[model samples]
Target: MAIISWREQMSLNYPPLDSEHQAFMKVINQASEDIKKRHIEGMEKMFQACYDYVRNHFSHEEDIMERIHYPEMEEHIASHQLFIKNISQFRQEFETADTVGKKLDASQKAMAFLSVWFLGHLISRDKPMKPYLVRLRNLPPRMNY
Candidate 1:
């Protein structure tokens, strides 16, 4: 079962960002499945993918926020940073686990965190950016610059 699935309500109406979010869902769901199957060896790869998503997607979203002059950019970035810190802790737990049972426990904890965080971030952070993005696109070409 998926930790969470992509929904239309999650879309910011920006294809680039929306696509990234959708792909992120896939990564999280796959990680959840691996955990279910006791695929302990694959957990590291899943963690790496999550890390990569945080690195690339957070910056991409940040860049768009800069372009749009988002008022809450700092707070939004802080949330992203907090997520990085939280995920890093989980990864460390997984890595330092002395046995497969310990590793699976860590993976379960990580997935639980990811599921809650991703949905909450989408609703609290990204959804509000929809109007700003629409206005940005609607701006005249000269003014957009």
Candidate 2:
């Protein structure tokens, strides 16, 4: 599994939000590496943490989106739902695997899925929302996540 690489392109020109995004990527990357190393138990905990982080992050982002009257809020949240679905699928695979070996085997593709989803979303879909977000937010929104 490949680690999610953060770069300038990932920056939405919003420092606070971008920082949270970076942390999200960090958690995902750690989980990916753990899975790749066949650290099954570590991987499981990290993956759970990743899911929790994503949900909290999305909630905070959505709140900002709503407060700022972000027009694409629904679509953005829909994207979040897709990520959660992917997370659930991986969790299911991890849970159903009869052996640590099977878990690791299944983890490879799941990590890849997460890497691709994160890179694509942050660079393409999420990045495009920044301008409107900047205009709407006007200031850093309160962060509860």
Candidate 3:
């Protein structure tokens, strides 16, 4: 089963950012599946992917916020930083796990953390940015960051 299912309410109504968010969630769900299948290597790769996605997506999103002069930019960036720290801690635990049972347990904890954090950030942080981001739709800016 998936760790977290993306729902309509999660949509920020911004396609570029929404797609980025969805891609990260896909990594999380895949990691959850890998844990169930005892695929430690797969989980490790997913962790790397998660790190990459956050780095790139947060940069991109932050840039957009800057462009739009979003009032909550600092707070949003702080939240992103906190997410990184928490995920890094989970990765440390997963990496230090020696046995299959230990690795699986760490993976579950990481997946649970990802699920909770992602949902909370999307609902509280990202949702509020929707109004500011909607302006970009008319401008049609590139999101390749």
Tens digit of lDDT per residue, candidate 3, span 6-103? 89999988888899999988898888788889998998997898789888999989988988889999999999999898889888888998898888
Per lDDT, what order, best first? 1, 3, 2
Query: Residue 38, candidate 1: how far off, in angstroms?
Result: 0.6
lDDT of 2 at 142: 56
As for lDDT, the candidate ahead, 1 or 3, is 1
Q: Let me know the TM-score candidate 3 reaches against the reference structure.
A: 0.89
Q: What is candidate 2's lDDT per residue for 60-136, written digit by digit as tens?
A: 78877878787778888899888888878887888899998878866776777877887888876678778887675
- The clash count for each model shown is 0, 0, 0
Residue runs of model 1 more than 4 Å from their true location after superposition: 138-145
Alpha-carbon shift of residue 12 in model 3 (angstroms)? 1.4
- Residue 26 of model 1 has an lDDT of 88
- Order the candidates by TM-score, highest first: 1, 3, 2
lDDT of 1 at 72: 88
Positional deviation of 81 in candidate 1, in angstroms?
Answer: 0.6
Give the distance in Å from residue 144's predicted Cα in candidate 2 to where it truly belongs. Answer: 9.3
